[model samples]
Target chain A: MSITEQRPVISKLEQQELRRLLAENKRIDGRNPLQYRNISVQLGYVEKAEGSALVELGNTKVLAAVKVGIAVPFADTPNEGILIVNAELVPLASPVFEPGPPSEESISLSRYVDRSIRESKSIDLSSLCIVPGRSVYSLYVDLYILDYDGNLIDASVIASVNALGITKMPKYVVEGQAIKKTDEYFKLDLKDHPVSLTYAFLDDKYVVDPCLSEEYASDFTVSMTVKADDRFCAIQKNGGGMISPRRVIELLERSLELGKELRTVAYRQLAGGNG
Target chain B: MLRSNEQQQRQRPIVVPGEYVGDSKFHIPGLNVYRLSDRMLATTVGLVRIDGKRVDVVALKSFYQPKVGDLVVGIVKEPGTAGWTVDINSPFLAFLPLSEYPEKRIRLSRDSIGRILEAGTVLVGLIKDASIFSSPVITLKGKGLGVVSNGFLLSITASKVPRLIGKKGSMLSTIEKGANVKLTVGQNGRLIVHSEDLNVVMKVKEVIGMIEKESHVYGLTERVEALLAGRRP
Candidate 1:
């Protein structure tokens, strides 16, 4: 129970209602067992940020903003650009979340989202390298959770990728070793589109895209990130529950299928229906 | 009728923030429209309603700003000595004082206060006092008010509450008759649909969603009826 505080206690009556609905293949909001909620992505809401997207998945809302700046790269990855993902679980989003430094849940969320984007090669980091050993462009993807209705990982992943898609880095005039900043900006080239799929472990069943109520009622959840080209990037099993080897395999196959369909939704929204 | 009406009104195109509408000298800037230098610009995204010489920007999404005498649906979060903290879907939680309670208040008694309004208890009441400097005050003193224990709550955009209720309760009557449920609508984008059958409550929720989506368009009542009757429009 790493979630010591800020976790809403699930009442017995509410759990019974949700469990009964799930057993009957009926969700609280009338969605199918495998069906995800109504997801819509609004791009470029924050003007000050280089890129921004407000993603609405049913009632769960997440805002992703990217800030581009010049900074020194890490020692080991000096030649490549940097990708930093920070998540804020603001108390205003849900009564359960607290207002302070990032909690354990938020830190884990940011790391998982970061691994999916970095390992999948979503952004071409090498191209962001203005200087091999010195200064490089650092992109910060900050996720602000505006609403908490469960399955936050999937929503945050999509919002971050969409924000990265719309990010524009400032251009610099390079002369020998000196670089001067210019008013012009160039869109960062996004290589791959990765989407995440989350499934909650209920009693002897796996429910995909669990709502807030269903999430609290469930025992554990598994989140899988897959690329558009059918490549799996990262997998995380949250909560203290054991899963059979057969169930793990079964989950991976189902997640891949859903990932493909969701990738198109995210890609199309980023391209304004052109994709 | 809709086509002629739209033409006669000279419909203003939908404008977003930073979009130029007209000159400030000729048209007075309304809500969400700010004057920059000599030009008028929109500060929010919504449909533009140009009335004579005044231009008003009506945002599609409405945030509830509290005012006195408005009926609202609130949920009790914490019980205090004199009043209970009720979340009225606003930036601030309202106070349901002991005077507004249906039961009489016992002087300096905490046990009696819990009996009146406890945590998780839903109430349908009216705002008795609202001050910018203080938390708004609510009262359970109106008809069809007090603890809402049997019904389900559904919310839509505050701007569409008028459309869902229709002009003079005509649209509301259509929904109630079509779904066979007693509906109470709040101006702050909350509603209570009471029906014995769970399906009727669900049907009313879908109808309200249709009203919100098509509120900007004309002839919404017929489409809403078609949705409730399970027919294709």
Candidate 2:
């Protein structure tokens, strides 16, 4: 038997109520329009992985694990280490997720995270290089959606960033064409932190960190990633609805502010020791 | 071993899947508890309940299992020539046949069925038949069973339905009277809340959320009553 994603049916009355609540700047969960749900970050959750983190945003839970290995660099970027991001919407996480190959949604999530991390230059890729072109460290960030209550992109980003921040790789020595491993290990050098903020636009009104029901009711969503230095690293708009340029700018400013707050929380957890 | 009456008075211990609940010799394995040789192990995350000689695990979170005569709030998924496919927040989609509808003899056409109950139309119904081999059949002929036109729907963990209803529907009545709203609770954890004031609806939603989260805790009813009276508990 084949398993398929089942979308929760939203009654017309609920939809109407959701719109009315948005007009009044009130949410069903009693949060303000620009406020995010409670965020909790746990580092080093997966002991076997080089680094791992579990982040819970409200009811949504995402786990990220980083596995580092030595591999030859790509032809175009021989000196820079490679970072591969993969996301899986685990079937057990939600009724809508099915066990199969990565869907378009998961692919888009991975790509969005990849752009945010790579474009922001969070990790010093040059430092991971064992040799100029022969061998370098390759980091694979695998994100598993443990619970999908919506705002998955932001939750995944938080987990990935914290996982990467605590990542430790075994030291390697260059001996001519080959690289030799050493007993010593060093933490991955992270230069910057990037946080993503997503907003679900319910008609003209928008809410930050929308829950599952809100996400389903929303017309479209815009996700903006900001670097620690207040730079816009990546921006993505999903769904069929369109947004005016003015709203986009407004969202960007909000993202910048929210991004700093998110970074503080992530860093505080990272510094407070493993959970 | 069975606990003494003094120990039984204490709160039930929460258990995770595969945890050793008790020995099968002293207590018979019940719901969500599997017998591994002579030992009973919990098969799901839940609270352990030992009643007489039976040990059962009441799951904290689970899908609703349909049973005959149980009231449910269902959303119409698709219309067929004979009936409509309805989602009842269960693993199996329940079926609502045209014959089961309260209406008199009507032509068997997809358009006719669609016009009667289109996709996403929320309604309350009774499970007429439930079996493992096929989808459960629901009937709308019963009183207070029909299309839910105005009220919005809210859902909590299906396992906590009993807690939300409370002893002899005491908790439900308290919330209804306190917030001035009527709730049509489904056995499947869905609730259709009827109220004229949006503020009352919000209060009901908040109270339900609190109950769902703290259903396992002791003295929850008293705290719920305190919260309803506009006092923080």
Q: Model 1, A1-275: lDDT tens per residue?
A: 46556444343334545566667776667778888888999999899999999999989999999999988889998888888999999888887788877789899999999999999998889888888878889999999999999999999999999999999999977788898899999988888888999999887777888889778778899999998778899999988789999998998899888887887876676664222
lDDT tens digits, residue span B144-204, model 2: 9999888778898898888898889998998988887889999999998896467787788
Q: Return the clash pairs for model 1, or none.
A: none
Q: After superposition, how far is residue A104 of candidate 1 from its true place, in Å?
A: 8.6
Return the clash pairs for model 2, or none. Answer: none
- Cα lDDT listed for each candidate: 0.83, 0.88
Docking class of 2: medium
List runs of model 2 lying over 4 Å from the truth: A1-6, A268-275, B1-9, B13-45, B48-56, B103-112, B196-202, B213-218
Docking class of 1: incorrect
Candidate 2: lDDT of B140? 96
